[model samples]
Target: MRKFFDPNLAGANLKDRLLACLGALLGIGLTSVISAAFVHPHGAFLLIAAPMGAAAVLVFAVPASPLAQPWPVIGGNTVSALVGVAVRMLVPAPELAAPLAVGAAILVMSLTRSLHPPAGAVALTAIVSGPAVLDAGFAFVLIPIGVNSVILTLCGVLFHRFSGHSYPHRVAGIAPAPINAALQAEDLDKALADLGETLDVSREDLDLLFGRVEYHARHRRKGSTGGFPTGRAA
Candidate 1:
């Protein structure tokens, strides 16, 4: 137990901790507001979306995940939910809907590049929960789920900025592009093939973001340590 809290390895980042708390609080508050205003009978949206929503906001929004973003977070959950509801309403039986719904959600979310894990729950909820959720029909996907994601993302962006952390931090391994151009799908593929190495983003954008983050993290650590900050590399 004592080992768990060792200062050298387990010390908390004050800024990060504060942002996390604020993110969670804002997520809960926003969900509560939506649920209350809508007069949802079960508030299951609150129960399910709150914790998962908070986590999504913290991990994807504040951190600026390469894989997770506002569009992905919101669209993924909403779209997957729509697919699930479609399965439940269109399919023959509840049990069949459950598994089919999950598969449909995953495939769509992946293709759209909005692969949020919790969207699976959203899908299942639409199917197994019966008339209460079914009564929502297609509206359920847009209302609470979409609204909650947008609100949480906005809050996380503000909180992350306030904490002196970069929201939407760039992935370290990728390289930036040489010019800012919206490449077509074919263009992007050609560019990647030209590079002869895989990257998460265009070569130009990657380079720019990496340089900025690398500088900030190293300088901040230096200031915090009150030394040259040896034995470390950003």
Candidate 2:
């Protein structure tokens, strides 16, 4: 229980952790306040969806993640909300609609390349929310869900400039052949194809990580204390 409950996140220091917390607060707080400003009947409409909380975690804590980028954050949540609202309206049976809504949302998110994890919750929220959501119909996709997603993602973009890591970081890409290559760019592509699943990390970032690990391993075995490796070179 203790092991399971303890922080499993690696490589994050106190400052990093605190910044993530602060970013979450700012992103969600502002999303709620800003979204509420224009939309009326505030009681009927939620200022922001609950899934935005999870989105805040990704956008701030793992800003480099492909899923945390602006397109995914906005498209995933908004499309999933559309899916959820559609499912709720079409299917009267709550039990069947719940699973189908989530599954269809996943399918759409995958095809769109907007597979954010919190999108699952956004889809579910549509199924479970009151008549106000269903009554809002397609408009629900734009007003609250879309608006909230845009604001929260924007906050993430602005906040990370000060958080020591770049936001909307590079997506996976092919690296040139190294002088002495153990891993090739094609190898990463083939491996991902064989895995048949999307990883939260970008291929570019994964390439960098593997290159660093290989550099350290080689140097450690040679027992040389040289300057830290910068990055992989062709």
Candidate 3:
């Protein structure tokens, strides 16, 4: 029974956790209100997409995640919604359409390099959002899905900046070389393939993380002991 629990629970401190909660409150609230103002006719589920709530968890709490980035948040939700709307229209059976929409969403998000997990919810929501969403047709994709994603992303960016955390946390910069010889890029690639499941983080990011960890470990050892030897070269 204990094995069923998630081991990797979020380890954020109280301050960071509170910041994420506040950000979610502001982001979702603004997104719902602003979106509904524009699409007042069927504003309930149509304007205020349910998936954005899941998105808030990613954007605010897990700011470092690749899935939380702007492109993934926006593109993933919008395209998945498109797939959902298309599947709903083409397939008359709700049972078939629901699963098909989710599956197609994974495929499309993979090809687009925008695989945000909340997008799965977006696809499923689009299918079961009732006649109002169905009647909106393709326009639904742009109005609610696209509009909501953009607003939420914007909120994340602004809030994170204000809270002194990087919003689009994925940054390009010169990084130190990896000192750990055992963990190569090729090895990570093979491990990813063997897992046969999509990992939320990129291989490059993992590499960088490992490299930084190795560098800091070495630095700490050198500082602690004057005669400490260097680590083996990779």
Candidate 4:
């Protein structure tokens, strides 16, 4: 309970939150405007899907996450939409179609290494959207879903760059200086394999984090020893 209520759970500072909000507004707003202009009738299917809103959260708030990158945004949503449409066409029943679409989308995204969480919502939308969406067919993947994804991604990139945040973050090629020399790439890989669960952070970022923590720990230990040798000289 104490851990759940920890102040650190709040995460980002005021400035970060402000930037994220602004980015979401800009991305979603522009995508909506574009969507409305092109998608005719402009009723329920107009503009963007509900998932795009969640995508905006990742794009703007957690730009560094692997799931928030350009490929993940574009490919994940597009492929999921495609899969959803396919499932809907084949499976007439909404009950079966909905779950199948989501599952298939997840599998495709995982295989493609473009696993964005919101893509599942996009898949669901494609299935349960009724006759209007079904009539639109595969074109649905291209126009609104694909277009919205591309636009949102572009907006996120521009917004993050302007706001001094890194969008489409690249992992550093060189590893940070390690305090524990025994900590190798293989060790990290083995540890991650042991965990057997997907983490939001990229491998590079995790490695950097471990390196920093070890460095801090070593410094703290040295400081506690008053910068003098702890053991007697031989």
What tens digits encode model 3's per-residue C-alpha lDDT throughout 85-181?
A: 9999999798999999999999999999899999999899878878887888888888888999999999999999888778898544324444665
Per residue, candidate 2 scores C-alpha lDDT tens digits across 148-196 of 9999988988998888788888533234444236767788789889999
Clashing pairs in 4: none
| Model 2: lowest-lDDT 10 consecutive positions | 171-180
Q: After superposition, how far is residue 9 of candidate 1 from its true place, in Å?
A: 12
lDDT of all predictions, in order shown?
Answer: 0.61, 0.82, 0.82, 0.83
| Model 4 TM-score relative to the real fold | 0.86
Per-model TM-score on C-alpha atoms: 0.63, 0.87, 0.82, 0.86
When sorted by TM-score, best at the front, the candidate numbers are: 2, 4, 3, 1
List model 1 lDDT by residue over 144-167, tens digit each: 666666666665566666666555
Q: Residue 4 of model 1: what lDDT? A: 58
What TM-score does candidate 1 get on C-alpha atoms? 0.63
Which segments of candidate 4 are over 4 A away from where they belong? 1-11, 41-44, 172-177, 224-234
lDDT of 2 at 197: 96
Candidate 1 error regions (>4 Å): 5-15, 40-62, 170-234
Candidate 4 C-alpha lDDT tens digits along 1-234: 655533341346667878888999989999998777667452456467889999999999889889999999999999999999999999999999999999999999999998999999999999888787888888888878998999999999888879877888965434434446666778888999999998889888777666656656777967753332221111
